[model samples]
Target: MLESLWAEMPDRFRTIDLESNALDTDDLTAFLTDPRGPGFRIRFGQLPADMDREMAWCCWRIAELGGRVPVGVLRSLIRWLAATVEDHPELSGSLMRAAPREWERSIAAAYARRNGSLPGRFWQENVGSTLRRCYEILWAAYDQRPWWRREVWDPTLDPRIPLRPHEPLGNHAVYFQQLEPLWLRIAIQWYFKVSLETGQLTWSTVAGPQRTALQVFADWIAGHDPVPPPWLREDPAGIRAFMLDFLSHVRGLITQSGPNKGKPLSPQRVNTLVTCLETFYAFMTDHRETAAQVLDEAGWLRLGPYHAMLWRHGEKGRRTRVVRERRQEVIDDTAFSQIMSNVHLLGEPIEGGGLGDEQIMRILMLVARTGRRISEIRMLDREPLLPLDRLCGSTGPADADGAFVAKLRYQQTKIEQAPDTVLVDAEIVAIIDEQRRWADQHLGPRWAQGVTPKYLFLGHNMNRNADKPFPPSRINQTLAVFARRLDVRDSAGRLVDFNRTHRFRHTKATSLLNAGVPLHVVQRYMGHVSPTMTMEYAETLAETHQREFLRYHKVTADGRDLPVDTRDLYDMLELDKRTDRILPNGWCLLPPRQACDKGNACLTCDKFATDASFLPELKTQQHHTLQLIDERRQAFAARTGQEMSPDNVWLAGRTQEHDALGRIIDTLEQTGHRTDSDGRAVRGAGVAARTDALAAEHDEERRP
Candidate 1:
């Protein structure tokens, strides 16, 4: 082929020279690549002997004389360089693998993945349009992040979006860095700009966080160590200490910003942050060379063994979504109480206070009782923010019956299945109604009329004073003032917080969950997208936690309904009586309905052994009595990652206690049978009769 080219252009060997130039350029690029090519050298006769000597001089000379290189010519030259032998690799693999006529079918297949599957040419023709609409939904959600407003984004240009970014929210940099570049490339696309639309940049929706992180990262690329701003610094050995300091400083600010709105991060914001960052990595990775250096270093702290270290220590602390050793934190309980106690204008000097404080308190009380968000409380349009004007103008049984049944309604929530109207239980409803009337009398007749605001708790002083509801932040700030007055000293007057309005929400959620509100129900009420989030928001009540902790090792078994009282530390220890002071670690089964009374059961039952609630105490004796029970039950219907019952919450060891108990019950029923009707049954007339006789004999022996 080369000989034929030389023969055709024998005078100058123009064709041969051009072909060699393309080859040389390709070879030269491969060499500069550090890893270099399999065998590379700067041979004198090679094309582009030195990159600078060729293009630098040509570029400089062309620019000197007011000459402009036509984009078409530049494009052709670059395309030529890309195409030669190397260009084929960049060609779409999917396209190349398919038959020419099947190319459309192949593209359709890629798109069908998004819309599920569709047959034939229908998807080929419609998927591009459908995919655009799908992305727009995501784009709209992303626009809320606000960085999309920047000038760099072109609203008109449609860009290809990759997968989401990698979010190492609580993870370290080392591990994250390995995947970070890939994630960034997925999110950011600087490849080309589209100016077809008059709207904001479409890519901005998902790329905001990645873009910000990238820009921040770019600054660090210029230098290292103690990287500016977000590029945190710390000795690996002292990372725990550094993190503690940082969290201590930042918690207050983050809390105030409402990130921890009585729950973990709001699902929307969390999704946004995670999605945006993952996409950011996707974008970065597209340019492999740039991605390697950029993403790896960016989240350096987020990667490595340090993350596991932090994770192991993350759970013992207070607060949902607790990170690796954040500095000390506590609920702004004092301020919360102060604010509520002074809800009426009766007890405190109100700063932003007024009927508004009462309204806020009432709102808080509602959230506490009903476990709803502040927004849910305020935006409840059906229920007037305040209580009714009066209970009864005239008093009588009939007149009292005339009292208005105050109820909340029209759920303004993201969840559609959630119930709308909260039936205002008696006690709180009357108080709220009275407060509204009091406010009207003080603020004037038109006050209630003018309070057409979207939110009801505002008395002024908040950033987004839309329609007059006080901003949630300002209210929280006021609450902080109370917290400062209360936590006045952290363990040692090392004053920690001012106030946080979320205390009420947390307290309420905690109370409800502790009281046994199903986490799913709580999630719906709190407007959480997931139950995991519900658990985070609901501060674990010490009462419930203690109870659970005390009885964690014990559970009902053998088809017998275990009384919850078995969980009480007081019950387990028989603290009331010195008899059961030390519970033996090994299992001990109490006789059915045979509760030991340490004098507390007298009110409910005359006999001490009658009521199940009056258990004397756990004896400090070791008896692995129930071991066989757990073994059999857990053999089936087990949920543990380990062999344990998965039923036992604290069965962290390699024991699926649920299955164990299941196995035991199956065995007890199957083998315990004395010619019984069914083998699986736990009890039979023969067993019951015998057990009763034994119990009676024991009772007689123990009788005082």
Candidate 2:
């Protein structure tokens, strides 16, 4: 049977025996001594007389898997298997009859004994691959399952995921071999493959956390008191009880491996496990016939509406809570500046205190400057930059500072209708230009062959056609390492967490809104499908407003100290939550329930208040009010041939506004250079200066 299977496979494998599953001593000698084969010239004369045929079969299997082990390494693996079977005697049949744990123990023993002529460490390292290949090939041949039903499902082998030649294989394989209950494993394989085909789950999700979630469930079920069999026996009620128990079990799980070994499973992780369980059962219940066909059992027909609705009631609420709790933290200006300044260090060698990749530096620069999601940046096309004139088909107006030079159309992976293009400045254009040159040079021969690279940031290894983009994992891992090495800290002195690149997106959105960019414009810039998603960043804006508001001491309209604490009033009035209370000059101190009867006479109303941050707008307002009084007085003189009376209603109101502005300006200027309670310079101190410069520029632009 093994001979027929070997003969039927693709010609990648070398033949062993045409008539028998096992090769004798002469057959093994002839195979190893053959000069036409993979040149295994070394030999082992001493062998277990009874197990020699099994050893020969193992070697032939290894060769079928394309492994070229040295003769010494091959002898060590065969000797270990022979020694293990001799000691146990239960595993004396074919190598595939033993479990993985048994093979692991024998391999450990071989390494310990320095089995064969190889050194102990060398044997320790080389024996694992030999045993693994032997087991993989034996199991594959024994089962003779279709590609999807096999232990490993490679996406590249699937016709659904478009293939590229010689590209580096990432986490592309979904392994079902370790999962328990043969029926459950086959069912998951069917659901996963079908999900990919139907566009329900992406290949990335299947190869990543979806597979992990399934594995967690399988491991849990294997250890359950009523271990799941190849065919489930539970009724709907029993299944519900079992599922609830599984949820609790998953909730109590502690990480047994990896960096977070001792920590409890996080809420996000627990949610993923529960959601996967819900989705799998729902799939199984919906397609009972398909499940039954895959499992080759009628037991799956028992799954019905009850099992399908297991997690529907409360799963969405739990997911929302987890999402809300995991809101991205916005990186502030100080920390962001420090990060950009030290970003070039990422290109230095790892041993030289850097992340050790020049590609990472350019990628990070683009991410920080563009505020694009990491996925968008990673999957950018080879030519993503277009000049404004070229994009619009006409020369667009350029500001004096020339801030807009081109438009960048990144990969719109998340939202279908969201805008993919963003106006970029010269700096961003330069970065894209630099990357384009680098990518073209990197794809040297391939570019010469007229094959255009698929991505701007090409994968570094095994991608001869430049078909694969740089991996997102590399960019994230590099950012983490870069942060740790630089010890980047926020204003609170806590280490800046760079693990989630989406924080950059949050920071960018917050900064734009604070700079007074309209909400609709910010929504478009973020490529959000709705304003609601962009409004999440408004919370950061509220924090900034409150911080600035409390930074300066406040005075009443009469220039007297406030009778109440400014912070207390800010909270009691809920000023941060009230848009109506926001004034062009400062803030409205009126209570929410109170009706404002003071039309345009806010200057005389007791509900009005001003702070140092409003000094620029106040000064501008004061100049306009005085200039208006003079202009009106002259216009009245020209019409009636006499100056307007001082008691005129309009003139009187203008005088009141002018006097009120003077009082506020005097009070603020007298309180100049004041700091907050922490003795830090107030954030609004520079606002006044920058606003004045902007106002002066506006006045110059309006000059006759």
Candidate 2 Cα errors over 4 Å, as ranges: 1-144, 156-170, 228-237, 255-268, 315-317, 321-328, 349-354, 386-405, 415-418, 439-452, 547-704
TM-score of each: 0.34, 0.65
Tens digit of lDDT per residue, candidate 2, span 555-623?
A: 545555555666676676573557666678865667778878978777766666667877899899999
- Candidate-wise lDDT, in order: 0.36, 0.68
Q: Per-residue lDDT tens digits of candidate 1, residues 1-704?
A: 22332233323122212222333322222111234334322221222222212222222222222222222232223222222213234333211222323433444444355447644554334433322322332233234333322223322221222211211110111111222233333223322122113222332332444444343334322343533222133445554554454333323222224445454444343333333333333333334444335434354333434422321233223333542112223233554455456445422445534423555556656665665656566554423533434455755442244344454553344344555554445565665566455544543322322233343343332112122343455446555654544444443345544343444556566656666878887776565656775656444544434433342222222223224343342344343444432222222234334655523211111111211111122110101324544554566436544554455544422233333333334433433313223212121011222345778999999989
Worst 10 residues of 2 by lDDT: 680-689
Best lDDT goes to which candidate?
Answer: 2
TM-score of 2: 0.65
